[model samples]
Target: MYTYSDFDRAFINARNAQFRAQVERRIDGSLTEDEFRPLRLMNGLYLQLHAYMLRVAIPYGTLSSDQMRGLAFIAEKFDKGYGHFTTRQNIQYNWPKLKDVPDILDELAKVQLHAIQTSGNTIRNVTADHFAGASADELEDPRPYAELIRQWSTDHPEFQFLGRKFKIAVSGSPTDRAVTKAHDIGLRMVKNDAGDVGFEVIVGGGLGRTPMEGKVIREFLPKGDLLPYLESVVAVYNLLGRRDNKYKARIKITVHENGLDKYRELVEAEFPHRRAAFNGIDQELLDQIRPQFKSPYFTTAPKAEFEKAYAKDPVFRSFVDTNTATHRNDDYAIVTISIKKHGATPGDATAEQMRVMADLAEEFGHNELRISHEQNVVLPHVHKAHLPAIFARLQQADLATANVGLASDIIACPGMDYCALATARSIPVAQELAERFDALKLEHEVGELKIKISGCINACGHHHVGHIGILGLDRAGVENYQVTLGGDGSENFAIGERAGPGFSYAEIVPAIERVIKAYLEEREDDAETFIETYRRVGMAPFKAALYPDADKGRKHAA
Candidate 1:
């Protein structure tokens, strides 16, 4: 974790003090709703349906144990008793009083955390693969570069306000856990033929009304040129991206209308100027930042006990299989503490649960934790021999759900429940789906499926890339869900295709059940995942399952 420098601490302290004054002024009637809207948004405060929501930034999803405890305290004292972890690896407190926001921010700053640049049409939180430094397949640790980008983009004078909000994700491994293809800027760390480390830069990818996978703008950019190249790209988008229509204001839209070649040409044209402008200052800073992310001194633990537990306890084995990933260290594993427990809200964590995670991190997890994009907490460097102890703690705290990539491990946005832009309820649908699958004992059987739900087309839930995607829509005063098949968010990224007409809230879960049942029957083997089966057989069988009556009627009509 990067410790705050004197300059970093000073800037944040001053900024929070300024926001505190602004909050007081707003509460005292010196600013109207219109006057306060942008100011509040800039400070990461949103006036949603019920109350003001505070979105705190967790850069690259990395957190120290102390920071985790700070979040727990904030959840307990400042706002609601729980906080919502978002797909962007940020945390949101949904019921904070407007007057209490400044106090909340002050507390966050105490632990080197703040909510700056979390909203208001600037570069949002720079995210990376949660397993960045720990994964076995990584070419390089991506978080150092992510931290470099964070420092450079913070209050960037040129990009303070763009055509619209922008997102960037960095991945260190060949497998794209960061959903790199679904970001405005995706940086995949790679090595060229010369074995020199650089990035495979992808631009124009995003998921909203017009979902798009990014185009590869640069195959391999030398590490020295990364900041400058990124500058050129964003600078080009800032110049030519649409401002007339908010809906068409994204960089994806810019790339969409002008074509990939033209966009690439424009970016390429600006690189020389950008390189001259950067002039190695950013590289010097990156060198300084790299040492801060050195790995912890790992100690080997005996695996005999782990093997004994694995062989004896089916429950522990299931948890290990579902929630753990391969680590660079043979003795260690990357453990995902599932926040999606059965029928509960996907990312909601009570303050007590937060403290439990914090204590566990400090005690056994190298004093480090990561917030995964899938609304779960990660113990990235847990020793295999310590798995049973960690599992016991998680079980005691209701955190041991053991469904990481299964159907029940669904990702859902705060829908109409908390977000003002939502057209229908999303939480209920996700809960019902998970509960129904768990009751049938079908989730474990139907393994490794990504089911994402978004309340509206803004695609906050990442529904555009789910294996089984569900989008909630408002149809004639009813809550209707439209399903999409064959979508994925990994390296093989693809947007889902709509199966058929929208299903009502009551009918959606059962419809999903039918689709999964069809997948089981239609798959070539049990090992073939839903996305694989969908791609192999096409959408006819799944569509037939979802709309047996509609398909029968259509066949008769034809």
Candidate 2:
């Protein structure tokens, strides 16, 4: 984990003081809601359905054990007993009081965490692969670069008020666990034929009303030129990006309207000018930042104990099988703590549970914790021998769910319940689906199914990438839900296809059941998972089961 320097400490302290005064003004009626809106948003405070929600940034999804404990403290002291981890790897407290937010931020600043850039049209938190430094397939750790980008974009003069919120994700591994292609900007770390590191820059990718896979703006940009190159891209977008309509304000729209070739030409023309202006300053800064992220030391311990635990404890074995990943080091493993317990709210962790995780990270694992893009927390470096003890501790805290890549592990957004932009509820739907599947114990039987839910067309829940995706919509003042199938979240990502007609809130769960049952019946064997079966058989059978009346209507229309 990266520690905050004196500079970071001073900056956060000053910002907190400013926000404290602003909050006092708002409470005293010196500032009305209209006047306080931007100020509150800049501080990552939002007025939600019932209360204010505070989103705190976990930079590149990485945190220290002490920071985790601080978050736990905030959750317990101020809001409800639990917090919701978002898809962007930030955590949101749904019930924060308007007046207490500054105090909460003050506590967060003590641990080098803050809510800056967690919301608004400014550059949002820069995300990277959760298993960045530890992943066996990684060419380099992407966090230092992500942190560099964060520093450059935070309160940037040129990009403070972009047309819309901008999201950027970086992945060092070829597997693309960060869902880079689904972001506004995706940077894939690559090694050239000469073995020099660089980035394959992809732009225009986003998921909202208009979902798009990013276009490759530059096939290969040397690592040294990354900052300058990124600056040029943003500058081009800032100058040319649509501002006339909110719907057309994103850079994706700019790329779509002007065409990729023309957009590339414009960006290329601007690059040289920006490159000359920076004059290798960004590279020098990166060189300085790189050493701060050097790999942690590992002990040469024997794995015989881990092997014995795997053989003896079925529960521990299951967790080890599903939740742990290979580390770059021999005796260490990356342990994923599953937030998706069956019948529990996906990504919701109680304060006590957070403390337990923090303790475990500090004790058995390195003091480093990671938040996955799937909204799960990870202990990035746990020795294999500590598996049994760690599992026991996590079980005590109710954090020992064995479903990692399974059906019950759904990714959902805080929909109508917490988000003002939402047209319908998403979290409840995800909960219902989890409960229904757990009752049937069909998760393991169905195998590796991803079900993502979004409240509206914004697709924050990533409904576009699920193997079985559900979208909540509003129809005639009633909440309705739609289903999409065969979506993938991998390197070979594809947006799902819609099943004919939408269903009411009550009908949606059964619709999902129908789709799953149909898959089990039509699949070649148990070996074929839902996604594979859906891909091989297409959406015909699932659609037929979901919308038989629609099929009949189509026939009648013909």
Candidate 3:
């Protein structure tokens, strides 16, 4: 909830004017596509299959109602009527025209939003736990540190161009909902033996062509040493990371090539000089910014009405049970407004829906919003007393899906439909799977299952961490799908194991159905979800279920 300082406002305004000029130059044929590519990418514009896509940063996934309304206005006035929320907690307009993007940035800057560093080989948007301050079990709010890092990283001259793009995520809760382990830099706030708060710094974790969990570079780093240590890590990576091969340019590759100990030693060697260079300016800024995150006023609203509604309304109960999370205050709850309606695109939210969320944030929530990496909009601080009415309002807007963390709550990237890198379709596969699970009425029965689908190996859909991951590929110029099992994205982070041969897009849905049926029949009890069952009895059973004809082929060979 930090408003822009005068310097911040001036800086963004100046950048926007420069970009507008660059856009004009490109449009006038003074610059070719090759020349304008880097220029547009720096401003978070991409040429997709049919049109230009604009990705706007939602720093740490935090937004005010006014900011949310700005996004709504952009969706309404500029591109299509809806926008796609991405895994990086950013929003993308898929059908934006190249000519209109600069205007969109101008509008965004009016609300303290921008598209800078959303693309390109620079430090990308800083992300944190959606429930950073409000989570009931969090050690401390991690957004202050995240904000500090954002201010330091954005437009830092030294890191403007690196071997590869870098991402940083912070998690305040023990549950690790932010998928910190899958980031270039992951910071988890923890209390030490003496109860002093600090960070557990992790480095070299990402999911792409090569998937690896981040390794702990430092067991405990005092809060004061955060920026200096981070600088050292990035500096080492910048020096040692590969640039010859674009595929291996990520810091994860750098960490993999150099052993963790060696990397730590290099970082330690540079830490002293970097630490001294800090000069406490970042800390001074952090001290000034921390006050902006004060908790909203809480009223002792009676919960009797919520209890009665939970008892009386099954639909409302279903929504509250599925979408609500425990809050720091007993009377407040964190509500996840799922954008994945059954059989719809996973992350697309209409302008009307965005406006509705803004209205709810203003009236019921603390006038703040968070976009979850799972592509859901979160009202992080809503009073329990307002649950029924909010649910009713959301229902009226077609925003009450009541399917958070369920089979129907799928995470998918825009595959062949929009992305040029995609080989197969992700949205259709996600749609089919979600619809199949809904038709079976087995999503809630399955219990706490995550299904992530990616169009390609880039892993934008986080298919690597899903309980049931479906990856689309182009095999022999045909669209084939691959499945992975037992992947997890929480505290127990693990890359999924592949099952077997790729299935046709048409066959993938039924294959997934077989896998689910196997889980339902083979699980010890309803207490065990798909992941638990897969862990207990490896991938053999699921593989067998997926390829039932394998037994006949073996029999014929015998």
Query: CA lDDT of each candidate?
Result: 0.94, 0.89, 0.93
- Which 10 consecutive residues of model 3 have the lowest summed lDDT? 94-103
RMSD of each: 0.9, 1.7, 0.9
* All candidates in order of lDDT, best leading: 1, 3, 2
Count backbone clashes in candidate 1. 0
Model 1 clash pairs are: none
Each candidate: how many clashes?
Answer: 0, 0, 0
Better of 1 and 2 by lDDT: 1
lDDT comparing candidate 3 with the true structure: 0.93
Ten contiguous residues with the weakest lDDT in model 1? 299-308
* Cα lDDT of model 3 by residue, 1-558, tens digit: 788999999999999999999999999999999999999999899999999999999999999999999999999999779999999999999988778878899999999999999999999999999988999999988888888999999899889999999999999888898998999999998888998989999999999889999999998999999999999999999999999999999999999999999999999999999988988887898998899887888878889999999999999999999999999998899999999988999999999999999999999998999999999999999999999999999999999998999988999999999998998899999988888888899888887889999999999999999999999999989999999998998989999998888999889999989988999989998898788888889988888899999967988999
Lowest lDDT 10-residue stretch of candidate 2: 1-10
- TM-score for predicted model 2 compared with the true structure: 0.97
Across 397-458, the per-residue lDDT of candidate 1 in tens digits comes to 99999899999889999999999999999999999999999899998888889999999999
Q: TM-score of predicted model 1?
A: 0.99
Question: What pairs collide in candidate 3?
Answer: none
TM-score, every prediction:
0.99, 0.97, 0.99
